[model samples]
Target: MLGAKRETVSRIISQFKKAGIIVHENGNLVVLKMDDLKEKAQ
Candidate 1:
């Protein structure tokens, strides 16, 4: 597991969700579409 702060991880997950980059399911973070996420990153 990543040794990041809970608040930091929560913020990151929220941001990613809002950006359509990821989804939360069953207490897990899933990458919805890697290609789209990668495109947005660049």
Candidate 2:
């Protein structure tokens, strides 16, 4: 969605996953911790 390269997107997703914000389940992407994501963004 960010129009980033496939590798770049993967790297970002990996970071978010490591941060305990997003998850992969049943072949879908789930946001489990929005507050932490927001805190990191800020």
Candidate 3:
């Protein structure tokens, strides 16, 4: 997705999880801090 390699995407997601930005449950990714992440994205 977004032209990123599979492993690279996985690592980024892992960082998000560790940073309290997201959580994985029941195979779903839940964003814990959308505004924070959104601002970071920009």
Highest-TM-score candidate: 3
2 versus 3: better lDDT goes to? 3
Query: Per-residue lDDT of 4-42 in model 1, one digit per residue for the tens?
Result: 466765687688788976755623434334334446766
- TM-scores, all candidates, are 0.47, 0.51, 0.52
What TM-score does prediction 3 earn?
0.52
Clashing pairs in 1: none
Give the per-residue lDDT of model 2 (tens digit) for 1-42: 434466765687788778877756612533334335545756
What CA RMSD would candidate 1 show? 7.2
Candidate with more favorable, higher TM-score: 1 or 3:
3
lDDT of 1 at 9: 57
lDDT of 3 at 42: 62
Candidate 3 — worst ten consecutive residues by lDDT sum? 26-35
RMSD of each: 7.2, 6.3, 5.5
Model 2, residue 37: what's the lDDT? 53
Taking the candidates one at a time, how many backbone clashes does each contain?
0, 0, 0
Candidate 3: stretches off by over 4 Å: 30-42
